[model samples]
Target: MSNQLFIPPNYKPVLNTTRTEKAIKLTKDLFENQLSAELRLRRVTAPLFVLKGTGINDDLNGTERPVSFPIKCMQETRAEIVHSLAKWKRWNLKKLQITEGFGLYTDMNAIRPDEDLDNIHSLYVDQWDWERVITPEERNLKFLKRVVRKIYSVMKRTEYLLYEEYPELVPQLPDNITFIQAQDLQDQYPGLNSKEKEDRAAKEFGAIFVIGIGGALANGEKHDGRAPDYDDWTTPSEGNYKGLNGDIVVWNNVLQRSFELSSMGIRVDAPALLKQLAIANSEDRAKLMWHQMLLNGELPQTIGGGIGQSRLCMFFLRKAHIGEVQSSIWPESVIEVCEKNNIPLF
Candidate 1:
């Protein structure tokens, strides 16, 4: 999410320009180490493009189109660049039959045509996506909290390692994460919209999870929009983390503010998927052929999510510009800012 932070003007790089390359490589390695150790995730190859109507698309907030084109090799197949591997991971888990506790992580690359490019967001999206099979017992609030704690633990561990390896990489992550139910947050500050509450809370308490998502608020408003498939909207808060400012969460939960680093939950079983589809008024999708497999329990029951690699790097590096580390084109305003601040863009 966009958060305002103090930037030092004319602050030239102390380290050589080569650090960007080294930084990205180290970031991948460090993140991989934590993910593999914590989630038992094994690296795998993922699709740059999946067949159209395959239900392999990431419907971020139920909007945004996939970058797609017709493939001649498969004449009938219209392949689209994956928005994220949220659905693909679940399918792979069953296709691969990955056992419980064993999971797969892929370096997912995507083009999000609708993404409003910000300091942290790029048209060229890249991140780590992982999914692991879970037993039926691991689907309650307690189980979810336990998994959240484990994920945070890995992040803490990774932060420590990064600090040690690159002393210049100064990141101050709070040891204790603040977990708040989406409804509780609304209840605490009903007067304020979602972003206001998130900013108020996370600013005071470091990392926070704003639960109670997918549906409308008490006033019949969505805490935030989320797609109906893949995730059981009834069970967990599909809207996850929203980081704090000093952080740019300027406006409330309007189109102005978005803070969901991960959209993970226990994947819906066949029963749950059908129910959610009906609720979302998307039952028609059930007949989409690709969804037929999922409806028949042909997919694995697992938990999966995507993590923003650039955001983590930017936060840790204390660099105001994400372009400093990631090799992506910058908007003119951002580019001007980079040049003005003498912060070299990679």
Candidate 2:
């Protein structure tokens, strides 16, 4: 949450403003098409907000407050701008009768008013939210790893495409992504904090998926917080592990830090939902319509996640600040730092 801006010494943008704008468009288009094809996902329309009290909106980390306002159309009922469409995508799968192995992806734009804006974090969020129906038996670590590899492949391919378009932007991603459990990472770097551990892992592997997020580790601390209802973070995975969810992190040579591009996992089933809800002291959510449908077997079993669009562009294009790729408000302090550092804000 530190607002301190870190600009690498002698940093220079690879593309000018006009070309950066064009590259952003190309990156989004190229990645989206390739991702959809690789995952068998059909692009679908998504909503910016959902009715309050429906348990449909993502309770990211179960802490950050969502931006909500009264809607005059429905007797002024409150509506909350979605943090992410984690649950809604699963609901959509059932509504559309999307068969197994097939899924949907949407351009999800959101406002995270509580986000601590930094070189990477932004108040405005844009990502590719995707979900696919899965069979009951396919909810294991092996299956989750398979999906992660597919997404990583799409990312690598997109990097190559960008290289082809802009020769100055050379591809740096490794051929394959390394996977490690969060507990193992914690054990490896017991003295380091969570972020430090991720930094070490990413730097060492270039790219890695830190599994078992949200759930408590051996030390009774979570690697990071995840909303209980969306990702299955309490299931017993491999030896001593407890979740099927994780994050895709890579070493950002531009920032000299670990950069997270996505968070995804298998959607919680009825048992995992109830267990995680209780663990989170949020069993009351079971009464909401979305929860009711899930508990009653009305929703489909699925795996889904969100890949940050702006983050991808920033990383691939070697920008120092996220503002270089997407337009968003920034505090005067951040603006001053970037201005002094020659890191233009769009």
Candidate 3:
């Protein structure tokens, strides 16, 4: 068995597979409507793939290779399955003329072939990818916190609705979320690794927003990796923070670990983009078409993020394995282990 797979001792699912399916639908509907209403987002159709070389695909963590193939038509033009709509949404904000304070949301599906499969990580990824237009003046930490609170409120509401529908599943989220910077978290737990720090914070606070990701911390290491093109990770924010992006992590009672639900931040302006690109040693990306558009001020200032759909469902339903909620291929050993443990895999 993979050492990463941790099956909670004496684990049992709250909802059976049949009932879990129904709850999944309800969970998605409740969360989607609440999130759209909370964020002023409109549901929109999104592409499964984009023409390669446009620089529209998100290079998550500046690593993982995208699943790409060539089209049979149009002289075999190469196309890449979108990693996420991070860049495409901003471009669409301009194409669709999305005004400030309004945004777009889509059901984003992706395949991360290189993902290290575990209980949480899967090759088939699904999320609610959302982006919103913002004014240049509203690109600081305060604005970011306000948006985070709004999203967390939606989460709390969704959990309440879930409880109303399924009495077996009780809501466990706290009334409010705590915010902390990567530097402070590092200082608090000087001996722990990034994941360990997150576990400690989540256990203490129930929920936390780990700010200042994608940049070097005081220890000369990053709390996490973020692609430079989409999020403004090098921007000077409150205090000694160097990034405007962060992740939402909550303590998972079922899994007994910190569970990350979303990664979000304000999109980069021309200066921030250039600075991040230079810092990442990826200055050549500035010449891409999408980069050129942003550099030339053709895209809107925006804040956007991807919230894991299956991750939320798994957490809400108290499923020990993510595959219980989402359909995906699992290794033989994992399947055997889950089966032996009475953990259903869809």
Q: Candidate 1, clashing residue pairs?
A: 3-247, 3-248, 4-247, 4-248, 5-246, 182-211, 216-221, 217-221
Ranking by lDDT: 2, 3, 1
Rank candidates, TM-score, best first: 3, 2, 1
Tell me the tens digit of each residue's lDDT in model 3 across 1-346: 4567889998888999999999999999999999999999999999999989989999998789999998898789999998999999999989999899999999999999999999899999999999999999999999999999999999999999999989988999999999999999999999999999999999999999999999999889999999989998888888777889899999999889999999999989999989989999999999999999999999999999999999999999999989999999999999999988879999
* Candidate 1 residue-pair clash tally: 8
lDDT by residue (1-346, candidate 2, tens digit) is 3257888898888999999999999999999999999999999999999999999999998888999999888899999999999999999999999999999999999999989778899999999999999999999999999999999999999999999999999999999999999999989999888999999999999999999999999999989999999999999989878899999999999999999999999989999999999999999999999999999999999999999999999999999999999999988887888888879999
* Residue 172 of model 2, lDDT score: 92
Q: C-alpha displacement of 138 in model 1, angstroms? A: 1.1
Off by over 4 Å in 1: 1-16, 236-260
Candidate 1 lDDT by residue in tens digits, 164-269: 8788766565776666766677778888887788777766666776554675556666666767776655654334422110111111121223344455666667
TM-score of each: 0.86, 0.99, 0.99
Clashing residue pairs found in predicted model 3:
none
| lDDT at residue 107 of model 3 (Cα atoms) | 98
